[model samples]
Target: MKLRPLLITASRWKQIQQPLYPWVVTVDRIMRHERLGNMPGPLVHLFSDYGGAHKESLYETTAVLYMDVDNSMPWQVERLRVRQHFLPDGRRMSFKGLNDVKKQQALIPFLQASDSIPGVLLVAAVHKSIKNLCWSKDVRPDWPSDRAMRHKWSPRTFERALHVSHLAGLMVGGLSNPGQEVFWFSDEDELFANPTASNDVGNLFTMFTSVYANHPFKQIGLGTTAIDEGDRYEEDHVALADLAAGSAADMLTELAKYAGHIPTKVAIEFPGEFSRKTEIITSWLGYSGGNLKKVMVVLEPQGKTGFSVMRLNW
Candidate 1:
């Protein structure tokens, strides 16, 4: 099957600092483009395609849910890796395979888009590498686990599952990341890529900190939302419809009103067909916030999802 054949302009292709996501999302990325020929960084193999194993399929779906949980520490790290192309100390993104016309076309605008967000940058190393993430088990993801499918469930196990999935998902997330610029889709017609600069992230955090000064909502990463100009999934909200309704602006606007309350949860809700598990609950560390509970992820064959609730009286 042929896709819409998305491509970037020639000028833009000549100066891409990071490989944008369209290459990763497309069915196959292995092309003869010359851009991929000169990559220079600590080379870490990317797990682009999924395996035919039960666990492999559930990786992304389960991982996103795991991060959504309230307590998880959201680390803001520089999103770059070394590929087998450029010089070892290379700060700029060097590629060789993307030298072809079509591939270059795809890379140009992605770089253009990269210019808007300042949160990303080159790096000497990262705390964790791509090999770290990939938490999948035989248990179904779209539905509840059998042991605690009903009301009587264990919060500890649920969190364990989430942590496992999160670690796995982070591996892939870090690899494909064009940097801190989260490509967001908004319902009203906005395509956002979180600024990659530390200042940009700090600015965002400061803005939220001031607005949410009184609200318990501790601002996490430069939050984002969806715009209607959607075609494919990048990250964050994978499903198109989920990109609608809510946007970074909307959430900020709403949260501004609740500055006086304890920020139990920062609502980053989006529209249509959002992650089936709108909210993920887990206690992987074997502890919860008393009100904390268990999160069950049941993965269906083609990536369908279901949820379960567990109450732990700690």
Candidate 2:
């Protein structure tokens, strides 16, 4: 399917900032990689897996959401379990043979129509080149020999990306877990609300020490380096964050088509702790009253002269 189009207005372009420039650029880079194939192998693999018929499914699964379910609700648990394992389009499978599995399609709509749970989804996207560059310069001691040169991203490289994605996910999750013992983190439902939330926050900085890590703290005027990390991206909530990050990245790629300038990064996130007033949550599935919300933060280069747009739908 064709990507959703964005019509970036002057006001939207003005929202772009210096810190987000890296994210915008990375989205463009990844988009170029879509045609040129230069991104890290794992990411390229992810990009390749969602093509033709599977593209919408990728959009569904990858667009992670921060879900909150009542711990005592058994049906809610069962429904989520099904969603976690099955495809978003509801094509469950029974592997009858080594290479062939019976397809059981069309479960999601029924499930949603019958019993939909309420939760919030938070997501973000950013460009990796800036972080990659920052890593090679300040962190990667042996840049030339880094495995990423061979398109095999070093563990640190992968960790750095994962950490950033998870961090963004955590920031989004924090908004919804107001009073719950366990909060789902992503579409995969792997991670949850737990004590490790602090460790999850800490690991972000430890994994990637680029200017981006320090940028958030810097933006908030917190010069101290120590941070309390959140859960890994394996969680469903994190998957939503991944979805958001990926969606933002994808939209930025299309935006580059008309802007005539390669951006640094395009970060689309829920207004954080400071911007609570701007946070808006609407029912995404009609009358279900699902605690779903969508945040669209647009930005452009500091002194650029053009505007373009891209759209990411859930």
Candidate 3:
């Protein structure tokens, strides 16, 4: 089959104040490694809950969003949370706030409309409006923009992530070798109110960390040293090392298998105290050999930007 044309929009979500430790570094690392020329065209859209960044970063974001957009198309985006406006066709853009509910609220319509575009991918901070959102009837995923999204965001397993990814793929006629992508963020059928078993969360993180440890794959990006705003594309990159000993997936799968059913909620939970769980989960996942762990921008660094307790896994 011919390679696909895909557009990806990924935002690093944060609910904390301190620096984004190992996770953002990981995301940056992965993004720097995001060189998928095999496909027709690739565009990346990235945003962050934390703002006040230099224009260089902001400009990069705009450039990515504008890539491949027909110069004459009527493409405009108004982001309230970031206090920015985008008219890629016109090359006009502006940003407003770091955390404004009104601004964030406005994006709902835009997100709902995204599925209509062919091959368009949407990865953002998990918003209730976005989560509970239902697309308009006229919108379908078969569009070129939506099709691009389906090509990239497909899942890696039988989890909810896979459900969402596959749904998008099916919507846009996007198919990789059936086994290539199995990830789905989740399906509405699996979208009921989450059931939080007290210890289940902790166990979930511990298990995934183990999988990372034992998995044969290494992070596609280079992990860097600890720093506020860690180096963007550091000089030296290391291939990921082996885990201490065992793999987490093997045990967890067995745990689930013994139950004779898939787990509806297998979360990597945190201490009973905090409302935001990303950093907490990231830390827990770090039990791997590496002192500083790597995750995505979704998780916080708990004050340390480059120094995380969790190790990066494959």
TM-score, per-candidate, Cα-based: 0.18, 0.35, 0.21
Candidate 3 lDDT, 134-225, residue by residue in tens: 13222234323522221222131122322222222221121111112111111112222233221222232233322222222221111112
Which consecutive 10 residues in model 3 have the weakest lDDT in total? Answer: 236-245
Q: Which stretches in model 2 have alpha-carbon errors above 4 Å?
A: 1-64, 71-117, 132-248, 259-290, 296-314
Model 1 regions lying over 4 Å from their true place: 1-100, 120-215, 218-314
lDDT of 2 by residue, 210-298 (tens): 32232222111111101213211132223223323443444444444444433324433322231111111112221223323343332
Give the range of the ten consecutive residues with the poorest summed lDDT in model 1.
Answer: 120-129
* Ranking according to TM-score, highest score first: 2, 3, 1
Candidate 1's TM-score: 0.18
* Candidate 1 global CA lDDT score: 0.22
The sequence of per-residue lDDT tens digits that candidate 1 reaches over residues 274-300 is: 121111111111222222121111121
Residue-level lDDT for 192 in candidate 1: 23
Q: Which ten residues in a row have the lowest lDDT in candidate 2?
A: 43-52
Q: Indicate which candidate wins on lDDT.
A: 2
What's the lDDT for residue 209 in model 2? Answer: 25
How does candidate 2 score on lDDT? Answer: 0.29
